[model samples]
Target: MTTLAEGKAPVHLWVVGVLSLLWNGFGCYDYLMTELRNEAYMAQVPPQALAIFDAFPVWAIALWAIGVWLSMLGVILLLLRNRQATTAFLIAVVAVLASFFYQATTDLPQAMGGASYWIMPAVIIAVTIGQWMYANRMAAAGVLR
Candidate 1:
């Protein structure tokens, strides 16, 4: 009995929003821990990866922080059903892409122990883009105000 004209929020909106929130929440935690140089967390990181982290210049570290914080904000906006989530996510995608490009094009990739280092970044970028697209769709559908 549901109709598109009713402007009812689809179930998928909540699902995607919640999932994006969780993913971005973890991202924020990881970024904070790395930035703080949490010994326990860094201890668990592979030496090669730790080396790459240690080598990040100030600007690179800033870019990384921007990317993570924006994505986290985007997810919060999404869960709030705000139209601003689309903008937040779009900018986040760009920020993430910049960070990923810097990591891949710089010496960082080779510094990584293996191909596995690329996987997480790839997934993060993909999910950020997906979240952006989902938010835009919801906005167009009037599911997000």
Candidate 2:
């Protein structure tokens, strides 16, 4: 494993950290806006989609919240160069997968049944897993301590 200089984070760490913060920050924003029922934001969402969200099981919603919050926490921990980021990201991955599986089992409206709908979930999964793997690599390399 590659060992970084003591207390010196590589340039790539900053780049990934900033990008991850932005990405996960938006996720947190989306979650807050949706849960808060922000009129302006909710106005743009399809009613059918809203209905579907409203009907989500309590467990699924809990998983969704866990995924969003933990992912954001993972990004923060990553920026802090904490090895715990790996564990946080791992939990986020499982929460995201659970939430996604719940959504997939639900009946979605035609408007939400397009390629974009499926593609977004795939992208989320990819990014979530990527974050976990990246954190794991960094931890193993001694870049995170």
Name the 10 consecutive residues with the lowest summed lDDT in model 1: 1-10
Candidate 2 lDDT tens digits, 1-145:
4458366898899999999999999999999999999999999998899899899888998999999999999999999999999999999999999999988888899889887899989999999999999999999888898
Candidate 2 segments whose C-alpha is farther than 4 A from its true place: 1-5
| Model 2, CA-based lDDT | 0.92
Clashes of each: 0, 0
Q: What TM-score, to 2 decimals, does candidate 2 have?
A: 0.95
Instruction: Tell me the tens digit of each residue's lDDT in model 1 across 1-145.
Output: 6545355567787788788788988999999998898999889987878778888888888888878888888888877778898898888888889888888777654547358877888899899899889889888887677
Give the Cα error of residue 27 in candidate 2, in Å.
0.1
lDDT accuracy of residue 133 in candidate 2: 97
Error of 2 at 23 (Å): 0.3
